[model samples]
Target chain A: DAGVTQSPTHLIKTRGQQVTLRCSPKSGHDTVSWYQQALGQGPQFIFQYYEEEERQRGNFPDRFSGHQFPNYSSELNVNALLLGDSALYLCASSRGRFYEQYFGPGTRLTVT
Target chain B: AQTVTQSQPEMSVQEAETVTLSCTYDTSESDYYLFWYKQPPSRQMILVIRQEAYKQQNATENRFSVNFQKAAKSFSLKISDSQLGDAAMYFCAYRRAEIQGAQKLVFGQGTRLTINP
Candidate 1:
């Protein structure tokens, strides 16, 4: 089965520039979550999307937002990006009632 | 709020040997879940193993196993017969059992494991 897929694999944007990362949930999975992983650090939860609505969000500022599509694909949009926003964005997919999430390779965003 | 902590910043093991990574979490909720995820250089978060809060017995996955101590909120991962492919950044994570927003993994800073041949 196809696992969670994200794009583009890498990105470079300047400060104040807006960027949107896309994710396709794993086959047969319905829930998608986003995370940010800094170099040499574990990923931190950014937010989660279910049923096409954002269900839970982390401590990220309003600049971070996400959407889940009916087909279970998701997108993470970050506005007014800062240099600190540079990190690896990970997308994970999971099915209902079970919390074992499958993750994508992640999109590496570099803010200049 | 739930928080996971990994005290070890790095660890090393000889090929074919065993090593353990430590982790602790803080959560008031009785029912929850804990997990260990491995991210190799490829940067993909791979689930190594998981343990349900209510389960006393540790969970094992072939070469990977967890030692869960509920009273102390300690969940450690042990990797046996380590190979070069085992080298990666290991993260300990926790999640609320009743939470409904997918597997919102609260993660530790991570332990970088280096397997030496």
Candidate 2:
């Protein structure tokens, strides 16, 4: 079974540009969550999507948002990107609100 | 806020020997879950083992195991019969078993492991 899949293994964008990252959860999972991993640091939670609605969000600003489709796939959008937005964007999926999660390889975003 | 700490930045072990990575977390919640994830150079997060606060027996998966101390708030991972594939950045994570979307993982910085022949 496919665990989890993400698009655009690597990306480069300029400041003020909008970028969207996609994620497909594991076959049996129903919840999708997004995180940001900076250099030499652990991942920080961005937000979570369930039932086609945003359920929870982290410390991120309005510039960051996400959506969950009917098929359990999700997308993360970052607008007005700042130079500090350059980092590894990670997507994790679980069966429910809390359970064993499976993560994707992650998309490395470089904001110039 | 819950925080996980991995003091050892790096460690090395003989190919066939055993190694343990230490981890300590600070949380006010009594009931929570602890997990160990291995991230290789590919940057994929792989689950190694997990432990529940209510469970007394530590969780073990094949050659990977965890030492969970609820009172001390310590969760350590012990790798037996270390292999070359085991060389990766191991992370300690904490999650609340809640029903809300607030249930998210808090990860430690990470410990890079190296295996020598």
Candidate 3:
């Protein structure tokens, strides 16, 4: 089974533009979470979506938002992106409320 | 706030040898989970191994094992018979085990492993 899938392996956008990254959850997983990783740094939590609703969020600002679809897929949307928005966006999926999460290949976003 | 730290920014291992990556975490809660994720050049986050707080026995998966010290709040990963393919940036992560909602994983800066043949 496909563990997890993310679209647009790589993207380039200018400042102030909006971008949407997609994630398909692993088979049998219902919860989806998003994270941002900068070079030489660890992945930082952005937010999480479950049952089509946002359940928890990290310290990120309002510019970062996400949605979970009925199919268990999710989308991470960054609006009015800043140059600092350039990072590898990671998507992870888990079953129920388990602590272990399976991650995707991640989408690399480059803000110019 | 919960935080994970990987003191070693880089590590090297000779092929067929073993290497261990260090990790330390700060958390107020007693019950939690720690994980080792391998991110190769491909940039995919692959779960290497995991340890549950309540379990005293260190978690092991074949050639991958973890050294977990609950009292010291430390978790280390040991890779046996290392191969060139094992080279990657290894990240130590933490998550609250009791949370039923969206649990966020706090990750360490990561240690880049280089396997020399």
Candidate 4:
């Protein structure tokens, strides 16, 4: 079975620009969660989507948003990106709320 | 709010030796799940080991095992016969046991493991 897959292994964006990262969840998975891992730090939960609706979110601001399609793929959109937004965006998928999540290779976003 | 902490920023051990990485978490919920994930330079987070808070027995996966002290809220990973491939950033994460909505994982600051041959 194919694990979680993310698009654009790397990205470069200017300040105040918007960037969208895509993720295809593992086969047979239904939920997708997005995380942001800064350089030299652990990943911080951004938000989670289930049934095409956001069910849970972390301490992130409104600039960070996500969408989950019926196919279980996800898109993380960051608006007005700042230099601090430069980090590795990771996408994780699981069967449901209670199962273990499998993470993707992550898209490294470099906000210049 | 649940928080995971990995006090060790970096650790090194000789090849074929055993090393233990420490992790502690703060949570008010009585039941949850703890996990150890290894992120290589490729940036894929691989599940190393996992332990359920309700399970008294520790979880083991081949060469990796966790010392889960539920009462103490401590989850430590012990890696035996470490190999060069084991050199990566290890993270400790926590998830609530709630089954209704999306349960997001809270991760620690990650420990960088170095395996010297």
| Each candidate: chain B TM-score | 0.96, 0.97, 0.97, 0.98
With a 3 Å backbone cut-off (N, CA, C), the pairs that clash in candidate 2 are: none
lDDT values for all models: 0.91, 0.93, 0.93, 0.94
Give model 1's DockQ, 2 decimals.
Answer: 0.70
Of candidate 3 chain A, the 10-residue stretch with the lowest lDDT total is A93-102
Cα miss at B82, model 3 (Å)?
0.9
Tell me, by DockQ, which candidate is best: 4
Candidate 3 lDDT tens digits, A53-93: 99889999999988888999999999999999999999999
lDDT tens digits by residue: candidate 4, B10-75: 999999999999999999999899999999998999999889899999999999999999889999
Q: Please give me the DockQ of candidate 3 compared with the native complex.
A: 0.83
Clash totals, every prediction = 0, 0, 0, 0
Provide C-alpha RMSD values for all models, in order. 1.2, 1.0, 0.9, 0.8
Q: Where's the lowest-lDDT run of ten residues in candidate 1 chain A?
A: A92-101
Model 4, position A70: C-alpha lDDT score: 85
lDDT string, candidate 2, B32-92, tens digits: 9999999999999999999989899999999999999888999999999999999999999
Where model 4 places Cα greater than 4 Å from the true spot, the runs are none
Q: Which stretches of candidate 1 lie over 4 Å from their true place?
A: B99-103
lDDT, residue A56, model 3 = 86
Can you list the residue pairs that collide in candidate 3?
A: none
lDDT of 3 by residue, B1-108 (tens): 998999999999899999999999999998998999999999999999988899999999999999999999999999999989999999999999775666789999
The true-versus-predicted C-alpha distance at residue A22 of model 4, in Å, is: 0.2
Q: Per-residue lDDT for A1-112 in model 1, tens only?
A: 7888999999999999999999998999888889999988889999888778787888899999888889989999999999999999999988863557899999999999
